[model samples]
Target: MSVTRRSLLAAGAVAFSGALGPLFASGRARASAHGYGPLLPDPGGLLDLPAGFSYRVLSRAGDPLRSGEGTVPSHCDGMAAFGAGGGRVRLVRNHENRADAALRVPAVDGLTYDPGALGGCTVLELDPGGGLAAERVGLAGTAVNCAGGRTPWNTWLSCEETEDRAGASGYARDHGYVFEVDPADPHRLGAVPLTAMGRFAHEAVAVDPYRGVVYETEDAFVRPFGLFYRFLPARPLGGPGSLRAGGVLEALRVPGVPDLSVVDRPGAEFPVEWVRVPDPSAAGTPIRFQDFGPGGITHAQKLEGCYWGGTGVYFVSSYARGSEGAAADHHGQVWSYDPRRGRLRLEVRFGPAADVRLPGDSPDNICLAPDGGLMVCEDGGGEQYVFGVTPAGEVYPVARNAQDIGGPGAPAWGEFAGVTFSPDARTMYVNAYTPGTTFAVTGPWR
Candidate 1:
């Protein structure tokens, strides 16, 4: 749901002294804020949270699945939570693995799309108290499952972040497509790829429930960068299986603005239009390299997480550095696209900082909080954290990954991903990219 300005201001009003403590008191996120207080040290050496908060390790990599077929997969990425009746919650999580992953998502009979591919999604049933009841594979046979968004019809969209084609990688077919996973029935939808949605390096997707339109982000880090896309389906609001019928895939184009990273200031607005992609499949050439006339498609570096808010769709460009072949430099940016007005506005932008481990850098996998704020996962260097950004743009740390499984001298801290909240807003779910672990944190939410 899109958060209202009034609600965000109200959430920002409740501030506590020393919001981020000494660690984050020197950055753009140093503004007065309200978090669950400074995170206390974790005794178990897994996760660090505020005094009154605690986390439970819901799933771990290399653990045995309840199905008894194979162990849990590594590199857990995107995920979504669904109501599973009787107050039970079901989680559909992505395993961003290739054939070389140590533990892969076991390919089940009906759910396997390609026996050679090793990336897919797993379903976790959590009881009301946040205990794992069952775990099983939901979708298999895809590669590099990254991040995806939930649909209005209560299903999860799993995206593959690779462009590996058939025979090139193994003995399978072309990858890099979006697959819908129904948490209620793991095998109902099967492993069919929504090809009309386009085949590129997809990072994530968000559905505009009102218009039934889907917004997509491409994470192509090469010179051509990546483009923001929208898929308009033939059957709007038809729920599951509606996207299979196919639709037009278009990329956002801003007149006179070829690269989005050029606009460094927040509140910068640009009138935008959608250009139809000549080839959704990009059989030979990639979509970003396709022709679009003198008025070309707009692109950005590291285009990542996105969600449909109350009025527009909020998306993130994790960062754009000049040294990295980008148009400009910035630590991070959050943009809002007003679909009705056909305009895009920069909501938040972080200034250049020498510290790479700050809470605001490389923000990924974002989701709207119940308190009218944003919970963003950090994909930066060193220690990783889940940062909370109030409507007023005050940033604070929510959770930290203290996965010290590699001994004291060798801490194994992985980037945070898949930051999401439960339906009741009482529990927050986050994933550690490496040493793949899912955490369910519950506490006094502000």
Candidate 2:
């Protein structure tokens, strides 16, 4: 979503994706341009923001969740913000709980679709200054509810990150699918799954509002890798953005460019085409590989987050390597797809290290900033930080989590995720995955 700001200062930051090569702009040069200024250490030792910037934990795991039986769950992932009018806003967030998490998702009778599923969603309201107004469970009894998109219809689409078979792992029903939630109603959250969106290892989704189409990303991490998919709504003219209404699913192809892996460098261009998929629903074998085998349809590895912007749709391929069945190796890559031009362009390329890994530097969730830049959350090792990549291609640290709760683990850090900004751009909301926290950041946001 394009962040609308109260002042121009809130308009100056953003971030990227893709394979590795000559960056679109020198990372060093972008550094010189300045961000919120170096993040001063957070005296609280939890989060460190720029000098004038500050943050507050809006919610935390184990804390009581409104309208629910117990406390909030951890692994907070994707999120979105909606204006509540009168200097208020609501945040719909995803809890990426797997089928086997010890923490339970409260089941609200008929509102629950699957009793065995542990992943779900939550909602919190923020005041003008970013203080918590209210909080509660938004969706329940689902599994691997990862990253999803915000719909113009004022709804949140929470995607399940698995194509798990039914009756498996104590599940009475199949677990891979998407569920829609309304930010305003905590009492009547729909427990239904949007099956027509196609089932696979879903990462994130972005909606093309004008066309009523939803673009999806897959991070299967298997031999077949994952395919970038688009869903065409069955009732486009009706303007109903429900995946439950059903639709046709398609995979992207580079046409005559059979090899398909051109995402490794900045400015790499390719002719993009959409191939129709016969079935929109499948588990282990996604339609991409089933209908068009290995070389038949073009695809990439670890295709993760996606965001629909005014210019084009931005997407990312977290990291890739032959080990993960990738055609090439790189830390990550960012690409923009313009349906109008039927073209795909590589925007940012991180690295081509022999090993495609972002030990402590991978960009996961993303949001468009008011300045027309990108806000990125790193899901890698060590102390994780949220980065702001300016429209001019400069990247800088925006916020940091110094929570000692995670304590010396291999990654030694909590993954910063679920990044999104208030519609007014006056507040920035993000999540820390481990000791789950929802932080609302405010200050001179330029």
Candidate 3:
């Protein structure tokens, strides 16, 4: 039942290739020329791109910094780039750690968190040529920063993806929430968590400007499925500093499908919508029980990477199957939600079962290339790798951690997580968590 890019395109043509199909429906489109073959080995131990591609390591974990900050933490997760004054690039990166272990905050003046485990968030200024200009800690004392989206006003929303209410230690209030950090500010902003965004295991956030809606995904890997949530800002264009004010939170529920079980073979045309769910922690709530599966399902999956491109919001589900039951339908799905058309459709699927055999389910963040293709971070095995897929649905490896610096097992940090392009779309920057490093790469494609 695995679907390949070629097969998916064929299916789309037969099912809805009219005016509704993707813009790249016809193979004659310019997207066809952007095709990239599989990865080839390079003698320099760097990513081997097509004839015109080249890469350079910009920043590495434990590397000395002019900011006087100590060593960068391992587990680098989500990140966002901004245009700094004087045509420099500012990047805000998140360190996903629960604070339960040793805290590795750099020695920056205003950077360290209280519990020490407030994972690291650093704002580094880079030159247009991909050189580090300046660096500072954006926020500190946050826990398990999984993934977050960038604000149109030039800020990064770093999310703490944890809900450890009761454990060996006591409960930490407001631990699982989203924090807004200003890359330009050397000191931490307000350190305020947007409670209105709902308290859950958040994986990533995607903002829709046209609808003024913020789409978010949960990463509950334990019991219930993760849930897809949408936050409606009380005011349109809540501006840059209005996230903590208030908003409405709603979950996703497929109507007409009673049993609501995960669909293993969800058709490309499966319909979905944002459904309101009662807050589990509501005061007057009397009964509480464990509810898994699709119907009466309280959550969705560990949705990792998300991006707004090609006239829609593209999101990925890191975990396709849970111990509760068989995977709903497919493993690692790329879904496109067109706000204008008010519809959601499956664009591609990845995993061992899919036609294209990817490394594993450890898909982290994603970015659309200037050539109109998709770049993915493979976070599964310790042998982390980055993948690039063409519009024609060709998947190939772009980079791998063969240098042995990432260590044995592919720990969360230091693994390749976030991928973004320069403002001119001529350069690509990739970051890893464990060893904490950022690589600047340029190729013929640019």
Candidate 4:
């Protein structure tokens, strides 16, 4: 079964897959000139990009979808791009809205899962020239639809970032599960949560195509922080609905490294192991709180964007501050895990310096660029930007969020999300978190 956006809403479920892409531009002179060079301000005052590049606002919140059933939702978060054949493309987007939000995803009949919840996903089909062709809601009525991963079989794993349970805060069913959205078929009705994937403050997931294992990250920030997880599904490469069959959820343990925040140096390597989570459902308590022997499972703060690349999975730790009760402080960190060798390596660390302009701190959604580098989205305070990081750890700004949503004196900087490239690597698609807007960027991509 394939899962493309249009196919999912019109039929039932369909599947499609494509590689994900860049991130924070560093303040270094050399890094600044590496990618497309300095960002040329956008006269429209929305997104600022380099000289040869241009962007178009494909869709915005409140705009009527092509289906005419409802309008585009707010707080667009994680997204993936898939080829729609005939040189066209389709995008599966997530809306991270809460139940109380003024603008919520419309609960279309049969397509919605929860009547009281207000988060889900929207699908946009772009023409070969990067023009909007069609738009519709692919999934609906899920809470806090946050970052998720793209399956090798071409389906999107839309994750609920909240752990709100049934009978709590107007919720009718338990949240915090991964729901698969097929962009290839549009006929499926009702959303089914993948319970075997575990229930926590889910952030993002990365699928190991070879082993058919799904790795997940938790973004919970409390006394226990969050734990990295891996779901060993019952059926490997079984396509859509396979994950629902069941799986064993386990947490990563970096031996003696109880807290990931303490690791400041890049290139740090540690042998790792996975401990089975006693309760993947988190029926009574969260998976992170459960006992994992004396050694315990390793934890990190703000565990966010995850993607599969190279020999393993690459995940991000947005930022850590000692004042916030973390072990050590750092602007940001990117770690890569090589499952083949059972080893974890920290590839990038923002700094010992407090400068946000240096490496663009608090990096959020990330992807491996077509140019063999990494592209990252910044979610920190002040001006937000999408940056690119070369294999050498050098950074350059790919795009900047120049949207003046606050009017006059108050300039609002909305963080960029859902950074992914087309299958042909000719166009880039991204989202602005607030005053939701999806941009289709085309330029001289090197």
Which candidate should be chosen as best, given lDDT against the real structure? Answer: 1
Residue-pair clashes per prediction, in order, are: 2, 11, 33, 36
Reference-based lDDT, each prediction: 0.82, 0.73, 0.62, 0.81
Cα lDDT tens digits, model 3, 339-409, are: 77666666665544543433344577988766566778877644566766656565555666545554367
Give the TM-scores of the predictions, in the order they appear: 0.91, 0.88, 0.82, 0.91
* Model 2 CA lDDT for position 64: 85
Residues 1-446, candidate 2, lDDT per residue (tens digit)?
01121012123333233322232222323333568776676778889887788787789888888655678887888999988888889999899998667665667665577888888888888776667878877888888888998887778888888877778767788877878788887544478777778877788888887887789988766667778888888865343234678888888888765433445657778887788876767754566568765447767777778998874688987766676566776666788888888888887776554222222245689887756667778775556777777666666678877786643553356888889988877789899987888888888764
Model 1 RMSD vs true structure: 6.5
Candidate 1 structure quality by residue, lDDT tens digits, 238-288: 988889999999999999888888886666789998999999998999899
Candidates ranked by lDDT: 1, 4, 2, 3
CA RMSD, predictions in order: 6.5, 6.2, 5.6, 9.0
Model 3: worst 10 consecutive residues (lDDT sum): 11-20
